[model samples]
Target: MPDRIFDFEKDFAGSLRCIPMAVRLKLDLVGIKLSLRQWSRLDRDQRGRLLEVPCGGAADRHTIGAMIEEWVTATGGTIDRIDPADSANWSNTNTVPEVVVLQAKGEDVSAPSLSQWRALTDQQRFALIKLTRPGHENKNFVPAMREFGLFLAD
Candidate 1:
């Protein structure tokens, strides 16, 4: 990750642009199963626009999920499920979940406060979680934290 927001076009040209973690979040939030290659074909503006679309509030969950599914299907993808509960709720510390816990394995990392994590954009949190995954060679969680502007220099 970089200090700047990820530019899909520049960074992942001619390659499968959707990383597994991002895909997971996208699927969880949008309730879609988008192919990595299909996602790569989308331009930066498209991706940015998707991120800009807010998907919060209790009343809007179903509506938001439907809109996301529509977008995915229109883009040649499919909506696999409608359950938004599967989405990662990084704001919840009491139930950090097994996958996230596994990611923190072997690292002397402290979980940030809910407010701290919530203050970050979804992408930043997603990057941190992905970088912290077990067996991930990069293990660049620290670097990601700094890059996302979540860490200040001493």
Candidate 2:
């Protein structure tokens, strides 16, 4: 699996503070709205499987969703739906989301240009959109930019 955990994960690097992008993508695909609290209740091994499990096909999605559902149930957490607004606009690589641009400006990092956005994979785009949403702490926004190669190390 790709190293989706950013340095901003802080204490979460080992157990994870926030849900990683890889798992988040799967959650979005499966339409499950998971919370940080629920994610924290899971053991390291379960979280690790979420990162390693493939969610690329019908079988994969079914398996991954089942695993997540089981985990949520075991944790006594309920599965919820991801906000549609939070999930859309990822397919249009031609245009960068305004929230991302504003977040980049706040961090003094340049937002990815249209061409750069176009070059990114769908997963990459999804991460940016999710990270830059309103009301998020956004500590990982800069780190994500670096991870995506939109921002360079100082």
User: What lDDT score belongs to each candidate, Candidate 1 first?
Assistant: 0.52, 0.77
The alpha-carbon root-mean-square deviation between model 2 and the true structure, to one decimal in Å, is 2.7
Q: Judged by lDDT, which candidate is best?
A: 2
Candidate 1: minimum summed lDDT over ten consecutive residues — where?
1-10
Task: Tell me how many clashing residue pairs each candidate has.
Answer: 0, 2
* True-structure RMSD for candidate 1: 5.7
User: What is the C-alpha lDDT profile of model 2 across 1-154, one tens digit per residue?
Assistant: 2435545554565466568877888788777888888988888889888878877666877787788888889877887766423345776876898988988999888989999988877777887888887777878778878877886798
Candidate 1 per-residue lDDT over residues 1-154, each given as its tens digit: 1123443223443233443444345456655555556565566555554445455654444565666566667777765664554434554444544454455454444445555666776656666665655565744665555555554645
Score every model by TM-score: 0.53, 0.80
- What does the lDDT read for residue 70 in candidate 1? 64
Which candidate tops TM-score? 2
Residue pairs with backbone overlap in model 1: none
**Native-vs-model 2 lDDT?**
0.77
